[model samples]
Target: MELKFKFAIASDLHIALPETVWDHPSRFHLVEFSIPALEVVLSHLAQLNLDFLLLPGDLTQHGEPDNHMWLTARLRQLPYPVYVIPGNHDVPTVESMDCFAPYYRQFGYKNPSRLYYDCEVLPGVHLIGLNSNQFDADDGQIGWIDRVQLDWLESVLSRVSKDKLVLVMVHHNILEHMPGQASNPLSKRYMLDNADRLCQLLHQANVKLVFTGHLHVQDIAYSDRFDLYDITTGSLVSYPHPYRVLTYERDRDAERLSIESYRVEAIPEQPNLQHFSREWMGDRSHLFMLNLLTKPPLNLPSAIASNLTPHLRYFWANIADGDAEFSFPNFPTNAKKYFEAFSDRPPADNNAILRL
Candidate 1:
């Protein structure tokens, strides 16, 4: 049988109403435009005849009940079916965490009590949305998949037909998008705590495509070990504000997936959203760059770190924008090479066609 479908992903929506808006001086996300940016994307998508929309996670500015309510209500108004999972920001506290599955119950949670679910979105397409938000022993949230979910996943995959296409959607990344991402102190939080176990199950199940968010970058990472592809979308409230539309086709001959990414460049409040957001992130990049320089492998002296921070002002912004290539010819060899490694390695981040 031949199968084809089109879908859209708008991850890390971080939807915030005016009353729920909060501020932090050094924060990377711009929650102020979340609502408007989503509206723009939804308006555009409504015209696309999308099979469904997948919001991988971070559906609110915080785990505020109001924000969740607002997002669900808005999602209901859309013409297409929508599915969501929980991000760290979506369920920050243990108290609010239980409410996530219920609030968006209609989206994908057939069982409101459980945080994850598997459903057949189309005739031959299966979507498994996993909740990665978990509270640690100290009640602080972490990105992880519990053993119960793993066993449940194994059972579900065992029942699935090998000819059907399985698409996994989770909030935390299962593959590293950056160099040393899984082990890097600064980036490990965005990655699943037990990614190896999850990848094993995915590989065994022959699941090829995984959708994720939370790192807030436009990246498509492939794992040779698992033979899986992780397509992570950037935040709608962050720099360049990207979302994706994908087309998947399968026939007796072959299968292919095509990806196209779009950005919310301007809203009424910000005429030139891309330019403003890039500058907004650049203004806040100093401390982030300093941390990168002083942490782990680099561990540069404070004086040298400060000197290099200015030179890398737009480094992360370019990364978030995707398909970025970097060079710092005048900088020290180690620093230059280290920064360049973050560039889009291969296959491409923004747009591409892949054989499956």
Candidate 2:
């Protein structure tokens, strides 16, 4: 059997037009060029004759009525099929969730329960979209796969042939992409609350690939226990803005997966953005690093954390810039050694082929 298909992934779009761009003191979203940035990517992808496109989620700035409207209209003009899921920012509240189904009615869902859907995207590929959004009493968002969706997923996967490729899509990390991703307080929110249970089921079903967003970092984390790969794409509006093109092939003789990543290096009005975005993020990394070091997994003192913040200031931007080879030789011994753990690369890094 020779199975081959081409697809593109662009996640965490944070598509904020001029009016939807809100003011926040601590916010790090560079969403001013969300539209133009997407246009640049779409313009490039439109010519590639892709089999399909996977948005995975964060399709809007804040699930704004106008923003969703803008994105839906824009996607309608595209040449290929697109499948989308909702992210935390897209469904922050229960009340705001009503608009998602109707806005993207054409994309994936078979009926009104449009938050999640399953469809046959190609001859031997099943595309499963899962909604990771749930609301708490305080109206805050959480990432979880509800029981109904899980049951539905099991039913769908049970029927798929073993030869068929299963591609899962969600808005949260399903694998630990960072050092303390699953247990660390600050990082846990970016991962699905019940990732282990979901992983067990997918692994049992021989699902090899899952597409996810919501860390705004480009990472490919494999589940040693489950034999699954969670390919997380970065945000289009953030530094080192990235998107991916994946090619998967399977035959009687071999099975292989290859990934190629590209960054939106420039926008119409933001010339030389690749150089300036790193500087902008470096300037703002102090508070973020302080919180990380003082929080769980490290628990360093505030003064010590502050002193260490500058050394690891570009740590996150580097992670977001995928294929990161991070090392800290010039820092204090303990801090340098501790931060190095997060930078370790997995065997299946980007821009390469892996035998399945």
Candidate number achieving the greatest lDDT relative to the actual structure: 1
Cand. 1 TM to true fold: 0.98
TM-score of 2: 0.96
Supply candidate 2's per-residue lDDT for 11: 96
lDDT of 1 by residue, 147-202 (tens): 99999999999999898899999999999999998889899999999989999999
Q: Model 2: runs farther than 4 Å from truth?
A: none
**All models: lDDT?**
0.92, 0.85
Residue range 1-356, candidate 2, lDDT tens digits: 58998999999999988988986766677888789889989988977969999998899888898998899899999989988888888886798776687778778865655588888999989999899998777877888898988999899999988878889999999998988788888889999999988999999899888899999988888877898888999898888888988888888899888899888888878887777778878888899999988886678889888888888879889888876776878766766777887774774445767677
Provide the global lDDT of candidate 2 against the true structure. Answer: 0.85
lDDT of 2 at 264: 86
Q: Deviation in angstroms for 127 in model 1? A: 0.6
**Can you give the TM-score per candidate against the true fold?**
0.98, 0.96
